[model samples]
Target: MKKSMLAIGAISILFFSFIATQPKIYAQAGGSSVPFLLISPDARMSGMGETGTAIADDINAIYWNPAGLGFLDYFPKQNPFDENEELRPFRQVALSYSPWLPQFNADLFYSYGTIGQYFDYLQGTVAFNFIFMNLGEFNRTSANGDPMGKFISNEFALGLSYGTIIAPDLSIGAQLRYIQSNLTPTVAGQQDAGNGNSVSFDLGLLWKPQNLPYITDRLSAGFNLKNIGPKITYIRESDPLPTTLNLGLAFNIVKDEYNDLKVAGNFSKLLVKRDSLGSDPLPKSLVTGWDNPGADWSFGLEYWYDQVFALRAGYFTEPSTIGGRQYWNFGAGVKYSIFHVDFSFINTVEANHPLANTMRFSMLIDWR
Candidate 1:
C-alpha cells in the first residue's frame, strides 16, 4: 500500500545520503550508520585531499584533531605601558556548506558551523560544533496511494570538544557527540522505521617537537580515534557507528617571512566490522575490523604567499576492492584581517563519479 511505498522511499533517501557522503573506502560499509559523520567539513581540508589531522592548527581542528587547539593563543593582555603585551584572536568561528552529490542534483546539501572560546583559567580552547545533512523533501502518502503531503528528511550531529597541551610538545583532545536521523516520521501505518539516534565520542593527540635535532619545529604528527560508541537502531535492526582510526604527519617545506609551504599525508582505517551474523560489539570490532583487507591514504600540499593568499592540491586513493575513491582536489583561500574564505573542487579520476566536480565553500572569523 501507500504506507509501504513511503517507507521504501524514505529508506532510499537514507541510502543515497550515505552513499553520497562516503569520501573514503570502508571494508564493510553496510555495517555503519550516519556515514555523514565521516565527512570532511571545511573546504580547506577538502581541497587538500581531505587531509587535516596533522595541520589542524585552526578552528576547523575541532573536527580534525582537536589537540591542535593547544597550539593556538587567544586574546592576551594588552596595555600601553607594556611593550611586549600580546593580543591575538581569542574567539574563532567557522562555517562551511556544500551541495551534496551534485551529479544527482537531488536537493541534498551539507552544512557545518562551529565556535570556540579560549578560557584563560583552563589554558585551553573549548568548542561546540553542528553538522547537518539535508536529504531533500519526500512526498507523504495515504493508504490509497494519493499524495497526502510532504515531509523533509535530514540527519545531524552536535558535538563539544576541548583541547589542551599536556606537555611542552604534546597535546590531547576529546569530543562528545549526539547524532540523530529523521528519515521519516510515523505516517499512516508505517512506524517511523527511518528514525534513529545515537551518541559517540572522539579522542585525539598531536605532537609538535621544538627541540628535535633536525625536525625542530618543522614537523607535526596526529592521531584520532573517532566515533566510538554503541550502535544505532532505526526501528528493529541496529548498526554500528562509523568508528575510525586516523593517523597523519605534516612537514614544513618552506617557512619564511614572505612565503610558507607545507605537505601532509593521512592514513585512515574504518574500525567497524559486520558479517552474516551481524555487527560486532565495540572493543571486539576495533580489533576484528582490522582483519578486513583495506585502508585509505591521501597526501596534500599547501602554499601560502605573504600570509594573505594560498593554493592547495592533494591526491586521495584507496584499495579498489573497497569502492576505491581516487580523486584530485584543488583549492584557493584568501585572508584579510579577521576573515578567511576558502573554496575547493574535486576532480575524480573516473569521469562522472558521483563526487566529481563537487565544490565546497567555507569561511572563518577570528576575533580578538
Candidate 2:
C-alpha cells in the first residue's frame, strides 16, 4: 500500500513538472474541429461543474468514465429478489438535451442518449452512446453577396464502450467512436461543402480502495484520455480533434442512512499542441502541450436525502489566457422508483458571456 501511494505521488510530481516547464503560447481558442464533442452531455455531471471522472457510478459513466461501470452493483446480496422474485434490472438508459450557448441563440441545441447493461457471466459492462448537435441555420450567399437560401449545420457521434474489472480494486475501460460533421451543403461555382468523418477512442482507469486507515471507503481516483484520433478536414485545411486528459478525485464527506454528502475535484488539459509551423506531431505534442495555459480546474459538492433527492453546486475556471471562462453551476435531481430526472443551470461570472444562463435536462430509466 505504501509503495502504491509513493508511485502515485511520483507520477503526480512528474506530470506537474512537465506543466511547470512548458512554454507559454498565445493562440486562438476553438481551433479544433467538432468542438461540440468536448461538451459534457450528462446533466447530472454538468450540474456538478462537469467533474464526474471519479464520481461516476451510474449509467452516465458511459460518458464520463466507462471504468466506473465495472464497479456498478446491479444485484445486492442482501435482497437479490423481492417477493415476486422478479429479476432486478441489469440495463439502464439515459437521455439528455441542452440549449448550447442559449444566451446567444436559441436555435443551437445538443442531445445525447446512452444505454448500458451489465453481464454477470462476462463480469463486465457494455454501453452504447449517441450525441447530436445542431449549430443552427445560416444564410448562404454567392461570392457576389447575393442571397442563396439557408443551410443548417449539424454534427453527430456514435460510440461503443466496454468496461471490466482488471484487479480487486482497479478497473479499466475503452470506447471507440465514429464522428461526422456537416457544415454546409454547396454553393454555385464554389467548392461543394463536404461532410467530415473521423474515428476516435477513449481510455479510462479507476481505482477504489476497500479499506484505509483514516480515509473512507468511498474515496476514488480516476484518469481518462479522450478524443484520441486523426484530424478532420472539411476543406483544404485540416484540424485536429479536441483531445483531452482528465484526472480527478472524489470522496464522501458524510454518509448515513438518510443523508449523504460528496465532494469532487477535477483537472483537465488539452493534449493538442501548436507551434509557429502549425500543429505538431501527436506523440510529442501531447507532452509539449502540458504547459499550455488552457488547463481547466473544477470543484463540486453534492448532498442527498434518503437517496431520493439531491442538490449540487460547483465552480469551474479556465485560464484567461485560454478562453477566460469562469462559472458557477447549480443543479437538482429527483429519483422515484426506476425513474430519475436531473436539471442543471450555469451562470458565468463575466457579463454578457456567451455561455451564461445555459441549462441542461436529463432523464434516466433502469430496467431489468
Candidate 3:
C-alpha cells in the first residue's frame, strides 16, 4: 500500500509538473509533426520506429490492449488468504503475487500512462489512461536570437472503455476520452493565449477464431478508431486533433506452449489533411498542413523464441515531395519471470540528415 501510494504520488507530481511548465502557443506557427506517446516499452524494441500493435500481458497491457486483462490466468493455485495477496513487486501490480478474482479483478498501471484498471466477464474492461509529453525548453524569438523567455506545450487525457465477447471468437471495445491542451498564453500576444482543450474517443475490435486453416491456433485481427476528438482552435482558429484509423493482422507460424513466431501488418490513415496536394487557405498558408497526409503508413514483423527473446524491424514514410521521407526502425527485447524489458532504435534510411542516427530508449516491468 505504501509503494502504491508512492507510485501514485509520483505520477501525480509528474502529471501536474508537465502541465505547469507548458508554454504559450504561437499563432499561425507550425513546425515538425506532433510527437506521439510510445505506450509499449516492450514493443518499442521491435523497430516499428513508431506506435504499433503490441502483445500484452504486463501492466502496460492497459495501454496496448485492455482486452488482454481477460486472458490472464493468474492466481490459479494460491491460498485463500496470503500476505502479498494485494501486493506485487513490480512498479505496478505484481501479477505473480496478485490474486485472480473469482469474478473480477482490478489494478492500477502506469508506464507512459497513469491508469486505474478493472476487468470482468460481463464488462470487458474499465480503464483510465493519462499521457504527458515535455517538448523540452525553447526560447521564442524573431529571426534574430533575442530573449523571448521560454515556452512549452503539454496535454492530459481521461479515458473510459468497455469491451465484451460479441462473437464466440470475437471481442470489441470502445473508449471515450476528454483531452486538455495548454500550448502557452503569451505566445499569442493579446489574443486569448490559445489554451485549447477537446474530447475524443477510440473504438477497437479483436478476433481470434476457435479454429482455422494451415495455422491451427495462431491468428488475430484488430482495429482502432483513434483520436476522434472535437475540432478545437487556439483562438477560434481551429485545428482538428490528428484523428486516425488503424487496422492490423497477426499470424503465428508455430504456436506452442514454449515458443512462437508472429508477423503483423498495420495500415493507418491520418484524418486531417489539405487535399492531395499540400495547399491550403490563408491562415493555413503560414505553414504547410500540420500533416500533409500522404503516406503516414507503417508495417512491422516480430519473431519470438520461448517467450523469452524477441527480434523486430519495420519502416514508416510520408511522401518524398512533402517533407523528405520518414525513418526506419530496428528493435529487440527479453522477458523473464513476471518482468518484461525492451528497447528500440530509429534511424533515417534516407540519404544524409543530421538527426538521422537519433535513438529512443524505453523499458517495462510487469511485477504483479
TM-score of each: 0.92, 0.88, 0.67
lDDT of 1 by residue, 1-368 (tens): 22344554654544443352242333354357887888799999999997899889888898899888777756545465787877664688999999987886667789999999888788888999999988777777666877777777789999999999999999999999999988777766666567999999999999999878876799999999999999998878898898889999999989999999999999988887777788889899999888755788999999999989999999988776566778999999999988999999999998888778889999999866
Top candidate when judged by TM-score against the true structure: 1
Sort every candidate by TM-score, greatest first: 1, 2, 3
Q: Write the per-residue lDDT of candidate 2 for residues 148-265, one digit (tens) a residue.
A: 6666667899999988899988999889999998866765676756568899999999999888778849799999998888888876667778778999999999999999999999
Using TM-score as the yardstick, the better of models 2 and 3 is: 2
The backbone clash count of each candidate, in order, is: 0, 1, 13
Which residue pairs come into collision in candidate 1?
Answer: none
CA lDDT of each candidate?
A: 0.84, 0.78, 0.48
Error of 2 at 26 (Å): 7.5
Error (Å) of candidate 2 at residue 220 is 0.5
Cα RMSD (Å) between model 1 and the true structure? 3.2
What local lDDT does model 3 show for residue 102?
10
Sort every candidate by lDDT, greatest first: 1, 2, 3
TM-score quality measure for candidate 2: 0.88
